[model samples]
Target chain A: MLNIKDLKVSIEGKSILKGINLEVKPGEVHAIMGPNGSGKSTLSSVIAGREEYEVEDGSINFNNEDLLSLDPEERAHRGIFLSFQYPIEIPGVSVTNFIKTAINESRKAQGLDAMPASKMLKKMREKMRLLEMDQNFLSRSLNEGFSGGEKKRNEIFQMAMLEPKLAILDETDSGLDIDALRIVANGVNKLRTPENATIVITHYQRLLDYIVPDFVHVLYNGKIVKSGGKDLALELEDKGYDWVKKEADNLV
Target chain B: MEDLKEKLLSSFIAFESTLNGQAKSPIHKVRTKAIEVFEEKGFPTKRNEEWKYTNLKPILKHDYKLLSHPESEIEFKDVKRYFLHDTDTYKIVFVDGVFSSWMSRTTHDGYDICTFASAIEKYTHIVNKYFNKAASQEDSLTALNTAFAREGAFINVPDNTIVEKPIEVVFFSTNSDTEMMTMPRNLVVVGKNSQAQIIERHQSLHGNNVLTNVVTEIFAEESSHVSYYKVQNDEYTASLIDNTYVDQKEKSNCTVDTFSLGGKFTRNNLNFNLTGEHCECHLDGITIIEDDQLVDHHTRIDHKVPNCQSNELYKGIYDDKAKGVFNGMVMVHPDAQKTNAFQQNNNILLTDTASIDTKPQLEIYADDVKCSHGCTVGQLDDDALFYMRSRGIAEKEAKAMLMYAFSNDALKNVRIASLRSKLNLVFAKKLGVDLDFGL
Candidate 1:
């Protein structure tokens, strides 16, 4: 459902992602594991159409449509959702209202009528229940004064609300405790279907155990050097990214 | 420099002859002294410290005829949109400085909500006591309004009574002449242990060269609570100078909010005096101007007695070369021990050419007082803007939503429901969005 061919990306004249290729079919879960500054997050941001990055030479195709030419909101309307590592705090805008606007705007861009309020509320309630969130959480300002675990949980809640075709969770388990990690992984697992996909980006292999991935790729120095099945994550966790880095260096 | 002053000085006799029977009243004596003060000080120049940022030279060059009475009639349907139509209110409306009896809804059931022109003769003693008592005699603009003060609203809430409906005082200037000036003087006296709310607005029908100098004096007796709101959304050719003075007695609470949305040039002089102990005062203002409009707000709060508290907050958003100025001061007297006062001013410039000058001053003579003041001028937060846009909201809508959130704090404490909702709509309209929230 998504394809990236030799993606060469730079930011402010400094190359970050150099000649990276990746392809994902429908219903396949992929895990991109890397150490710090390996361009894992940058790849996700570029796919989500962040304006700061300059695509020096690359092409990104989503459902056979050129994704680079669209703005961030337009890409979002095409079912590209990025769960941020650090969710921003927007004061004075309630969580419910923010989600409502996002949903309606995306629908309007696709020539669809707005979702009925009753149906929206019902879906929101069910999703919040799945995430173990309180009823009052929907009324509070979007991410303002929210705890770390709550922010991560809220990101998953938004993922569920948007129901994107391809979701990218960038370090979703960074600041979460074990319980919050389990809740978030379980929520993601429940939403997986035969027609949707997820790209789990993490530094460690802790999140992959709950939401198992069909493919695991090791990103080193802005290039994916190793690709294997689920056992690759366990092998990398046992041995470290240093082995993979040395292998990549030898190949270079 | 002396041309406008000479014209005003020469026209005083002719204006006095119009008030035939009431020429020898106490108000006439006050008017005679006020005109003398205006003559001495004349109009303030840019050289003056208080008038350094605001220039009145361009407005003074026009030959503006001082309108004393109503010359044309205005239909209720034409101006009903300005009122708070959703709720019931005691409305005292004026057309060209004359009280529109057909358009006004005054009451005498519990307290007085009528015109000062009638109250000056009926409640002569009360009128004489608080007519110009709270206004500053030293300021030339207040003196100018006092010199030509003839018609405005007069509200008096009796002791231990709570006014059910809010009082709305609106002044609408019609485009009858090319250039016209009007002076409206308002007096509100809330008796002991009473509560009241007042909303004041000045608007013009058409874009004419109209200048308004209005003065309002409010007296809050012991334990009384009062809320006053001023809405200035006139046309581009309209200019206004508003002077409001408030006095709070022991245990009284008073709040004044000024919303300046549109105008060519507007100046507000708001002052509060806390004479008795344990009183609370709040001064809040929000200004949004575009084009070549200019809005200046000058406020002063005096904590004369011990254990009194005051809070002042003013926010402004300027765009398209508009200029805004804010000067707020909090003074604590030597005898006013254990006083608490806070003042803050925040501004956002939407364009590179738009600018804001803010000054917050605190003078505390009491050793045991807590006084603080802060001011800021900057653009919108880039991080916040990016964050909102990343969530599928367009850039323009996101910016508008963030601005609406930024202005929410200043309007949080508005006491009148209808007025608060009306201001919410106004803010939404100014931000160019149909907001789905209510105040």
Candidate 2:
């Protein structure tokens, strides 16, 4: 559903993602693993239409529409979601109210009426239960004084509510405990469908134990140097990223 | 004196000449001294340290009608929406500095909830003891208000008497002959163990320019409680210089909140004097102005006795070419040991042209006291804005959300739900958003 052809991106004339080529069809999970400063997040932000990244050359086409031409909210309305690695805190805005506003705005952009209060409440309650969130958590300020686990869980909760076609989980497993990781992966697995796709960007293979990906691509030095099946994750986890770096260096 | 100052000084003299027969009245001495102070100090200029950021030349250049002329009457229905109509309140409504007996609901039976004129005539003892006592004699604006303190709200809750209803003091400037000015002087004396809530507002019902120079003195006696709320939302032709002072006694608590949402020019001088032990003072304000509006909040809290605490937080959002100023001064006396005072001012400048000047002054004398003050002025967080927009909220809606959240922290202490919802609506309207956050 989403295609990228030789996507060369940079920020402030500094090269970040150098000539990237990737494509993903429906009902597929792609894992993009890289060490620090390997252009993993730059790729996700560029695809989600964060205006700071300048595309030197290439095109991002989603569902036959130019994704780069649309604004962030427009991209979101067209079923593209990016779960931020570090969700910003909005003090005095409650979690439930934030989600309610997000859902209503997306609906309004699609020329639909606002969801009824009762229906919205039911859906929220159901999703909160799926995420194992407490009922009292709905009234707290969005991400204000929340723990690391709670922030990631809230991001997943938003993804579940929006039901995006292309959802990018950027570093979702970085700050989670073992139990939180399992719960987050379990929630993602339950929401998967034959017509939707997800891109899980992680450094370790622990998350792959639950929501296993269909394809694993090793991203290094602003380029994807290797691509393999899910077993490659375990192999990289065993041999470490240093070995991959050496192999890529030898190729250059 | 400058032109406007000389005009005001002579105007006061002419008005004072008519009260010759009643010179022996109890308020005569106070009025005489107040006029002298006004003459000696004149009007504050930009040279003064406190008035450096706020210039009064433009707003004071108007030739105001201190004395009223015959004008059309205001209907109850036309002005009813301005009141907190959901609940019954003791309202002392004024139309261009004149007490409207028909529009007011006052009582002198159990408690003294009446006009300042009647209070000075009937309850001279209470008025003589508390009126102008807590306020400054050095401030020319306060002295000016005292000199013209013929109309205002006079609320007196006796010792151990908790007022059943909140008091509403409203000053409305309607269609006048020329540019009109009104001075509202309020004196609230909550006796020992007493409690009362008051909401003060100055509104202009017409497009004509109206300058309201108001002064309010509150006396919270031993162990008493009082909450004062100032709602300054009016036409762009209105300007206000509000001076409020509070004197707290042992074990007393006082809170003053000023919500400045609209006006052409506004300057708020809030001073809290904690003279007794175990006193608590809370000063919070929220200012949201667009266009060429200007609002300045200058607060001073004096911790004179031991074991006292004070908290002050003021937040603002300036859009367009609007300007804002916040000066929070906290002082701890030499003998006031174990005192705690905290002051914070946060502002968001929406556009590059919008500006804010914030300063926090902390003068700590006691060695063991704890005092801290901070100030911040910046634009809304880009990361937060992006996060909201990526969730399908448009750019305007997202900016509104972040701005509202940034300013709503100061509204956490608002006890009035009806007023809070109205404020939320005003915020939504000002921010150009379709959602009402009161829900």
Candidate 3:
């Protein structure tokens, strides 16, 4: 579903991601775990086509199309969604209207009419139920004065609504409590389908216990140094990243 | 002397000839003194402190054909859309420079809702008392308008009368061969314990290059409430210089909201004199200009008595090569104790070429008073842009949404629902958004 070849990224002439390659097929889930400043978020942002990240030398192919050549909105139209680490608080724009505009805009890009209001409302209610969000939450401004958990949950709610082909949850479990984490993980697990894929980017192994990943990769520095199954997450949690950091330092 | 200024002097002689030797009349004496002031001041240059950021030379160069009478034969159907047809309103409409009685819906049940021309002749005593009472004789532009202030809206509400329906005054200029000029002078007197709301607009139909130099004087009597909405939108070829003077009495409250949605070169000189104790005055404005358009707002609030309060908030969004200027001044006299005055001006420049000059000039003589002002200029947030773009919304639409949010606060105090919705449509259209956000 997604392919990256020799992905080298930098920002403001400072190299962040060195040569790296990854691939994900449909019907699979991949979890990228790393410590702070390990370029985990950068990878997700680069895949989402953030303009600030200069793709020094890389090619990100999504569903046989060159994603690097497309704008962020164009990539979004092609089912590439990046759940932000910190959501923006846009005042005066209700969440319902924001979602409606996003959905209609994506549909418009694909040459389709807007979804009827009734259908949109039904879909929204169903999605809200999946996330256990209240009905009034749809009318509030997007992320304005919202709790951290609510912001992350709202991200998942949008992901469910858009039903993106490749969903990258960048640090979605950071500011959530145990109960909120369970709910968020449950929401993500419910949205998982054989036709779509998920990449859970986190700093800990706690979230993996709820939405178990099919593959686990440890990203140290810029490149993925180790790859294993679900058990690898427990191994990293048991022993800290110091040993991994030593190994990566020696290798560099 | 400049050519236009020199031409105006000669034009004054021709204008006076039309008056049929009413030179000894008190209003005519006021006009004669105003013309002398216009001659003395000529036209404000960039050197003048108040007119620093605005350059009137380009507009002053035009040999304008001052329209004394409305010659355009306009039907009700042609201009019905301009009125607030959905809402119950008392309309005092003017076509060119003449009162369109056929298109207006005024009343004589209690209030003298009529034309300025008729009021000057019929209610000469009342006109003589209030005419040019609040407007500054020192302002060359206001003086120029006073010299030919024979037309426009004239509204007088007696004491203790509540004006139930909103009054809408619309001025439309039709397509003329030459670049025409229309000077509308409006007088609104809200009596003691009375309340009134007004919406004034200047529009041009299928024409370019019309200048409307308007002067409006409002008197809010003791314990009265007045809400005025100046909805200024016109073609890029149409320019406007609006001079509005407002005087508030004891315990009176007045609010003026100016929406400068579209125009070529616009200047708003809004002055409020808080003459009595415990008076409240509010000045809210929203200016969104694009292309090479320029809009300047020079507002002043004078707290002359004790216990007066004033607030001003002006928001502007400039795109392309558009320019804006906001010079808000608040003056508190020595005896005006406990005066609470606040002014805030926020702007967002959408392009590299777009710019604004904003300053808050406060002159306070009273030591025991609260006066604060703030101004901000910035572009759209980068993180906000990325967030919206990643949600499948394009960059342009995202910017428009941010602008709408920035300008939403300035529209919060619009009391008229239909007029507010109409402004919402105009605001959305200008920002190129597709939502009827009634904020």
True contacts kept of each: 0.47, 0.76, 0.68
**Candidate of highest TM-score:** 2
Encode model 2's per-residue lDDT on A1-252: one tens digit a residue: 999988899999999988788898989999999888999999998887788889999898999999999999999999999988998898878898888888988998899998888898999999989999988889999999999999999999999999999999999998999999999999999999999999999888889899899999999999999999999899999998998899999999
Clashing pairs in 1: none
Tens digit per residue, CA lDDT, model 1, B256-323? 99999988999999999999999999998999899999999999998899999999999999989999
**Which residue pairs show collisions in model 3?**
none
Query: After superposition, which runs of candidate 2 have C-alpha atoms over 4 Å from their true positions?
Result: B436-439
- Evaluate every candidate with DockQ and list the scores: 0.50, 0.74, 0.53
- The whole-model lDDT of each prediction reads 0.90, 0.88, 0.90
Report the number of the highest-DockQ candidate.
2
Error of 3 at B333 (Å): 3.6
Ranking by DockQ: 2, 3, 1
| Better model by lDDT: candidate 2 vs candidate 3 | 3
Interface RMSD of 3: 2.1
Q: Report the poorest 10 consecutive residues by lDDT, candidate 3 chain A.
A: A240-249
**Residue-level lDDT for B369 in candidate 3:** 99
- Give every collision pair in model 2: none
> lDDT score of model 3?
0.90
Docking class of 2: medium
